[model samples]
Target: MYIFSGDFAFLEIWYVSSSIPNMLVNILSESKTITFSGCFLQFYFFFSLGTTECFFLSVMAYDRYLAICRPLHYPSIMTAKFCMILFCVCCVSGFLCYPVPIVLISQLPFCGPNIIDQIVCDPGTLLALACVPAPSTELICYTFNSMTIFGLFLSILGSYTLVLRAVLRVPSGTGRTKAFSTCTSHLMVVSLFYGSLMVMFVSPTSRNPAEMQKIVTLVYSAVPLLLNLFIYGLRNKDMKDALKKVLRL
Candidate 1:
């Protein structure tokens, strides 16, 4: 989730940066002469996809919780209808949340400063290009980032809060053990996602793009997803059992 979240955030920023002309574009009368690189457009498309994948993972987690904790109700709770509805919500929300920011960022004229101090296009870079005057585009970024962060935090908190309650109440010792395994996996995922988010954002300002690149690459590309695969895949007993069954051992 952290990987996808940051990737989507970066892509939306890049889409604007790549499409719009530099701050020079706004000052110059021939701004319309500017064009974006085709390669950047392709990358934008690639990065934007992370949003969809993140949402789908959330939906899948919800399904898993329903299956385990509410076995009898799982069929009804995770009905095909419910799954479709959740999928649509994820898809629509991703598109709606992303494109408007791209529009706002594109409006920021990148005339005077062409050097983007990051691995990829980011809100910081586009806002820097506000043509000597600080671009109000950063305002748009704050509103969007805050809104998305708060909303996701609330939903994630709510899901895990209920999950904790479910895990604690299992009757049998073995059942409790299994429940704890599931709870621990979910907690690990949540920690990896939110911890990386805070590390990247709630920090002293970077001196250069190199610092930002290192952060963005580690938190968004590698660590969190690796944690996900570890906690949810390798640690899953059913998966282990299935592997054993398949090997006839």
Candidate 2:
């Protein structure tokens, strides 16, 4: 907690907290009969948290850029109070951005065949099950998803490019190596996450075969959780030392 305490940390905690428990229960339990209201709530939250994650990832990329590329200004730019406000904006954007797609999808009528292929309340599957073909709704949701994913992906790419250029400009070999080391894990995590999401959503057919989709979804969700623990804890010496101290305390 001490090592990763802040707005981004809190947002990360909430991101995982929103969906992990339900996912765990669904994996262990047999009955998956979620009520109508429950389904919509789950769908809303899953996407909302995902949006929050996207925003937070972009914020983190900016944080790293500032820390490495503009170290002298980073202290003033990323002050605690500024971080809090940024996080609030991220949360609000996350929650507010998805309502258009969710509302458009939810208003559709599901006549029958309520079986949603794959784990969790997938929005695409829900649309597939709707009684009438909702071309307008599909177009809106697809456009929104594409815009969010690609926009953030581009932002992250740009930030990392700046960071890389700065790292290359460091005078000493040791300085360059240290600077690169600080960002490699984060870059890897971001690549793994955005790559999976792009494959999952940015396509003509997002609702692929259930088994294949489930595998991809699990890779994006569970694998990232494990990787984050390893990257943030085991990869970083300061975090490892902090963990040891916390345990001892």
Q: What is the C-alpha RMSD of each candidate to the true structure, in Å?
A: 8.5, 3.1
Model 1, stretches more than 4 Å misplaced? Answer: 1-47, 201-213, 236-249
Per-prediction TM-score to the true structure, in the order listed? 0.67, 0.89
- Cα lDDT tens digits, model 2, 79-173, are 87787777788888999987777778888888898887767676778888999998888887778889999999899999999998888888899
Model 2 TM-score, all chains together? 0.89
Q: How close is candidate 1 to the true structure, as a TM-score?
A: 0.67
What lDDT would each prediction earn against the true structure? Answer: 0.55, 0.78
lDDT (tens digit, per residue) of candidate 1 on 96-161 = 556766766666556764655444455555465557544355666665656565466567667666
